[model samples]
Target: MDKLQYDNLYKFLVSLGIVLIVLPVAALVFLFNMEPILISQADYDLLSDFSLQMIATRNKLTSYFISIFPWVAGILTCIGIVVLLIGIFKWVGLQKNLDKKLDAEAAIQTLNLLKMSSAEVAAKIEEEVKETVSIEAPTPPVSSAVNDHSSAMNKYIEIEDLCFNYFTKRYANKYSFERNIRMGKYCYDFIGVSKLNNIDLIVEIKYLKIAAGNSRMIYDVFERVYNSGVNYETIAHRNFKCVVVIVTPKEELPRLENIVETYCKAHRENASRIEIKCMAEESL
Candidate 1:
């Protein structure tokens, strides 16, 4: 059931239980504590045989009912208490599950919004660059590889800027850009701490322009991410993890996935602590 339905059901069960117990509990308390009044010997002797016989029959029936009343009340009270407890525990568990689900949904929504914002920023930058190039005189043609490399480098810088902006806003006081932490021989692009969750984050941003045959960029960055993750774990001696965000064209995702799978397979232990996410350049 949905949370609201479950909530209503919980309230119903609690109300029903309380209703069930009220009368039985009151009866038990009053009936069990009550004393039977006895007639005096003189009054008993004055009774006719016929009257006495009728009185004896009536008393026998009353005694039998009185003996059974307390047991009935006790059983009903127990059942009511059990139902009440069940309703309470069910309500508690339902609330906990809803909280977790809400948290997960919120996290996903935030990531999606970040992606959309980054995409808009990248598009604006590309438009400005195109306009500037159109105004300038035609320059000499550079080699395909060099031109590709330069374009890829510029894209990486843009991605880095977007990520930096995102982390500053997201992590606020805990995030740093190009933090100089001596993790062996390498330094990561960003570092942050989650004080609430007790986790340290190492973030790496890369733009793999492999769709135009610049595959080496992804491999080199992946290796660096792996090495940094290992070193951070070794030196920091605490809860630490690595996040690698790669921006590439959608056409190259299969090849990227294969490379990532192979690399992670070879370094299984560290791979568990390293999270690699690929974003389509078109989607920013």
Candidate 2:
């Protein structure tokens, strides 16, 4: 275990041992040394010997109970404290594990972007515009290109890395991220994680353009992707965001954006945390 965890365990065990050892001994001491005030003060007033003996017995019984009750209460308090600590420890451990699904953190993303410059950003914007005027309608990915999209995948990953790093700058240490992960039936291209809380982001990238005629498919894809993001949030009791990316000709961005915005408006409730980014390959 890490130092933080080891310290917590050590403190809990020591507290438990102290309670177990000290309480009983303290209770016994109180019982043995307890003085019966009223009974002792009136001992001489009792005329019947049997009455005096009964009073003495009652005083001793009362003393024992007085000593034992507080000790029982103390023991209960200690037990309760231990139980609460266990629950809290378990909760922290669970939070730590929640982000384990993602191997990288926002700080790492930021470090990778340290060498990037303003010129690069300007150049990328220009590239996106040029790419838009160059390519025609959404054509099918060549069977060869479709065979292994790893190069395109790397391009999207690079863009996502930059986006996440810039997005989570202030809370860099409190977030984690991953790429090309399978949530369920679908594989999300990127995922952002929250370390301090249960909020995460899911991202999917498309290297081709969306057709206007594919509204049903688009809507269903959004629903499935949104649900996939929610699945992780539900399991970890965190909030989630769903993002869709399109790497198409720059001219086609407006059309794809409209389709996504329409779907977002239709599913406003679940789509509140949903986002779509339509860009050209050169932009990355």
- Candidate 1 backbone collisions, by pair: none
In model 1, the number of clashes is 0
lDDT per residue as tens, model 2, 1-284 = 12223345545554564455556667668767978555454566754888779878987888788767877867766775675576567656754675553433542353244323445534433443333222422453577555334444445446656555544574467666654454334445556666665566676655444345555655666677788777756544557778776655577667777877887788888667668766664565
Per-model C-alpha lDDT, please? Answer: 0.62, 0.58
Q: Which residue pairs overlap in candidate 2's backbone?
A: 132-250, 198-238
- Best-fitting candidate, scored by lDDT: 1
Instruction: State the number of backbone clashes in model 2.
Output: 2
Which 10-residue window in model 2 sums to the lowest lDDT?
Answer: 128-137
Would you give me the overall lDDT of model 2?
0.58
The estimated TM-scores of all candidates read 0.44, 0.42
Candidate 2 TM-score, C-alpha based: 0.42
lDDT of 1 at 253: 73
Worst 10 residues of 1 by lDDT: 131-140
